[model samples]
Target chain A: LAKTTQPISMDSYEGQEVNITCSHNNIATNDYITWYQQFPSQGPRFIIQGYKTKVTNEVASLFIPADRKSSTLSLPRVSLSDTAVYYCLVVPHSSASKIIFGSGTRLSIRP
Target chain B: GAGVSQSPRYKVAKRGQDVALRCDPISGHVSLFWYQQALGQGPEFLTYFQNEAQLDKSGLPSDRFFAERPEGSVSTLKIQRTQQEDSAVYLCASSLGAGQVNTEAFFGQGTRLTVV
Candidate 1:
């Protein structure tokens, strides 16, 4: 199992870019880094995922360095609606049985 | 439905009672997952099924918790002799493929369980 560590909370102004980083020191070779966003009373939504380097989607981008020990989720031009709990999950590609989540970073976008 | 659907969005059960939560995965989806999320906490893995076969259940906290996907599309999570600690939002997710790639997992609004 690969565990993730991230900031407890973050605050950013609207229209600004916000970045949340998660550390997974013991990630396995077959593991991949994925990020999810969750709003109040709703389930988590997939934001982005990457094995290494960068993965860009319509909503967010995921950057992974060569070490694969840490990954960053970048939200561009965030708005008040972007406020939510961001979860970083490191799951092994070999098995999807353990899609674990940490405390997650609570992102607050203000005006 | 468009995504994973959970029944009885809100459930209240007495202590020591038995309760069952239902999850209807997307049509043609091969993988289904169950998670438990506590207040102010992230979702925790509970169990996973790959086409009616329970491939992994290592995340289940106790023996009282049981889940089954009989027809490969509908899943039910049953909690026997529920406790206060069992109170949380149960989430269901479905993916188009197995756990071999970085595919997308669609989640539901989740079933909020309150054990009194």
Candidate 2:
């Protein structure tokens, strides 16, 4: 299992782009970086995932540098409804690998 | 057309009683997972099932927690002799299969368990 470290909280005004970085210094070769967003009373929703370089989706973009030890999740033009806890996970692809969730970054989008 | 669905969105159980939380994964999904999330904390993995076989349970806290997916479609997480410590939101998620590295998990509105 790979442990991830991220900021505890962040604040941004509406229309601002918020980027949360996660560090997984001991990431395994087979691990893939994934991010999820969780709103109150709801389960976490997948945002974006990347193996290396960059991956973009409708909701967010994931940027992974050459080293693969760190990744950033970018939320564009965030709105008040975008306020939620964001989790970064490093997961393997086989045998029902377990995902360990750290204390996620609490994102607050101001109006 | 359905995503994962958890039943009895809220469950209130007395201490020492047993409670069963159900999870219905998307039709034909081959992987199902159960997690426990406390208030103000991200979810912690509880168990994982591939098809009808439980492959990993290292994250389950204690012997009181058990989960089973009989036919590989619906899973049930049962907590025996529930304690106040067991009070937390129980979440279930399903994915295409355990083979793909980037398979996205679809999560259900978790079952909030309260032990009083």
TM-score of chain B of each: 0.97, 0.96
Q: Give each model's whole-structure lDDT.
A: 0.92, 0.91
lDDT of 2 by residue, A55-103 (tens): 9989999999999999999989999999999999998767657777898
Candidate No. with top DockQ: 2
lDDT computed for candidate 1: 0.92
Error of 1 at B11 (Å): 0.5
The A-chain TM-scores of all the candidates are 0.97, 0.97
TM-score of chain A of 2: 0.97
- For lDDT, the strongest prediction is 1
Task: Please state the i-RMS of candidate 1.
Answer: 1.5
Q: Calculate DockQ per candidate and list them.
A: 0.72, 0.76
Off by over 4 Å in 1: none
